[model samples]
Target chain A: MTLTKRIIPCLDVKNGRVVKGLNFESIKDAGDPVELAAKYSNEGADELVFLDITASDEQRATIKELVRKVASVINIPFTVGGGVKSIDDARNILLNGADKVGVNTAAIKNPPIITELMTLFGRQCIVVAIDAKRNYDLKENVNIFSENEKKFWFEVFIFGGKQGTGIDAIFWAKEAEKLGAGEILLTSIDADGTKNGYDVLLTKSIVDNACIPVIASGGCGKPDDMVEIFEKSNVDAALAASIFHYETHGVKGVKSFLKEKKIPVRL
Target chain B: MVSVAIFDYGAGNIFSLKNSLEQAGASVDVITSFDKPNIYSGLLLPGVGNFDPAIKSINENSKTKFQDFVEEDTPVLGICLGMEMFFEKSEEGIEKGFNVIDGEIVVLPSTMKVPHMGWNNLEIKKPGTILEGVDDGSWVYFIHSYRAKPKFDDVITAESDYGVKVPAVVEKNNFFGTQFHPEKSGDIGKIMIQNFLNVCKK
Candidate 1:
């Protein structure tokens, strides 16, 4: 019962440099991914996530090199995602030093890829990243987490949130888990880059539906937002980019604040 | 010098583990098999993947040789899935483990998450070299679904709470297995790896 709540800082990489955006657009450079990764690792970030935002096949080597550089510099668990399209791509990233490979579009395109990666590598290394937005049109069919007073249902998105799959996020989480994804990296596009706070309703919905460990991402503004989402949901970890990228509060600062708030975080 | 050979099962990430080991002042080698295991002072069974594929790869390639290596009294450390393979058998896979320790690997209770993934504090159960310089309640990174329950409690060096006393570290004779990933664990993990190097030196 004392499993420590994890604080993860995500580095969205574009052309080997760390980038940040508002609602997954309007990109701004943060810094070097390797340097930022080492800084986060030393700052008590529980885990580091590197998302390759570039979609070009030519930038594959850059992503691999970035993974190697960052992995060599940091000692914590690092998960790499973004352009990973196949099992071989996952293997290449992992071999370059990533502990886990995150698949978003590819997984939605071929659901069996999750199982294939899990069977080939292991369930522990396959993290299915679900980019989702709130869909107000869907009628509520699942009453499990209906207590939340949100007007919309969660919908799954792919292609870096550009193309909406119209898939129910909660149901997709359950299927992804069954397909052998060890963890769910759930990012709420509605709250992403807004700094308003995490979509706790969306997060808790997935947490209630899926048995695997879920990492809540997007819209983490400050330490209190983390506290609120963690209190509201059973997410194993919370991921933020802007707060850490902008130095609004560092990983250690957030962990200390959470620790002060009686949250069980590794300080 | 502390010499260690990390067994390569052709799955999982070994780069960070190797980097951490070298950082801890040990000369490390990634060996495909356990052939001539006596040459290294310590052998590392790094964790990753499932019990069946990993065990199949190990058994098909280095089963008898690894048995001899374990019997040689050389320090052998198994990590995560690597640790699960030290048991008689695991619920995760149908293959029988090396059975270096008397135990069965069972899935974590349903109340807890399946992977039990995250950082959790350790409760040091006994005095062991692996816990040297590491605080009794220091946190370590854990990403595992199944854990080993050695029949003898004395083998448990540390346990982490996950709605149950999940064994974090187990040791018998020169054999050591950690349910957590010491390589990915930060400062405390570095200390534990250094302590293992010291054990090899001794």
Candidate 2:
């Protein structure tokens, strides 16, 4: 047997509640972070990631409380991301009990923090989250991918995918790994929220270049979508949001389907 | 409830281990060193922090009594870095290990990735160790850069093939160890944790 590919259920948290901007009565108690975490952990999710979208000062303590509650209940690997800028921020999250911390905008603005976090926390616990958008305005000396008579390169974006950094995502991924990041969390802004599927080209490009494990985030709508990404790219894990949060598919059902299709997964 | 304790390295998180241990039916305590007389029915060396600092902490915390626990029949469960420190020395750091078992720690082969950080299946070489109920080829969570190089090959009960014969489970007398973090390893890990606690009860 080989190292199985992971399936991660990502929950968007705002002020300590799992937020999706969409009403899903399917969720028990409507966005109780602790409940959803334990549910996913028991549903055969390989891991769980919570993207803290809350930006207030109170969010710091609230996120820690949610983390502690989630940690107390779930027995799976959990990662908390968003607005982690300094070592103190990471320590607060980790000491309260997060297995890993994912940094996106902050690491893009100041890349040295990746090394710093890795030095303070073990590399295994520091995951550098990269938000990338497809820039069809192909430029010189950038990794490019083409599909359906169109050629484009991925451009890195920061600040919840609202700001463009003008840096190539592929190059930045390698640079982050070089700077001692243990893993890379790659999210495709182009494919996100669009149920079509993940940006296979973007995921494959990053996985091919990254020696560290890569988690493909955004644009996974079904088990088939996961099968497509895993079949086309050797991504170590796949992260999904609304599809799971809204009960479109259960984590165990998705893994069973993938297993039937010959993808190794923990059952 | 039978009592168990985890020796904290002063750095890194042990909440998961502590919580999982509690779920596995034991009262868990976080200890710095073996200063107090051994009240624990079982002991755990958590898989976190760097080797040098962790060993330094372990050294500071009453090695003579801790060594007595290892020499006697107090089941000790070491995970990842916890398992690595049982050897004489490690390539990751300058400090030496407890020399509990005759071996040393070294980095994964250069051909493979430095940190084999993910889920891998164990190829059980010898059974009836701490992994008594564990099935062969069972998947578990692992996150480590260095591996054990034991002087006695028979000490290894199971190993994972990560382009190298990476030892997964090991046992010498009542002392036991796993290179993977069973706390994060889902159902299979639960079985191993339960089995370790069972040994403690015995």
iRMSD, all candidates: 1.1, 1.4
Root-mean-square deviation of candidate 1 = 1.9
Candidate 1 residue-wise lDDT at A143: 32
The candidate scoring highest on TM-score is 1
Q: Rate the local accuracy (lDDT) of all candidates.
A: 0.88, 0.85
Which residue runs of candidate 2 sit more than 4 Å off their true CA positions?
Answer: A21-30, A138-140, A148-151, B60-71
- Give the alpha carbon lDDT tens digit for every residue of B1-202 in model 2: 8899998886667888898889877999888877677888899998877888787777777655568755577889999988998888999889988778899998888776557877889999987657878889888888888899999999999999888899888899877989999999888888989999998998
Measured against the true chain A, the candidates' chain A TM-scores are: 0.95, 0.94
Error of model 2, residue B56, in angstroms: 2.9
The candidate 1 chain B region of ten consecutive residues with least summed lDDT is B63-72
Best by lDDT: 1
Q: Write the per-residue lDDT of candidate 2 for residues A1-267, one digit (tens) a residue.
A: 767889999998877777763221122223788989989989988889988887686655688788888888987789999888788888888877788999988898889998888776678888999989989997898988888889988999988887888899999999999998989999898888777788898999999898888999888778899999999998899999877888889999999999999998988
- Which digits, one per residue and each the tens of the lDDT, describe model 1 over residues B82-130? 8888789999989988888898999989987888889999999888889
The per-residue C-alpha lDDT of model 2 at residue B185 equals: 89
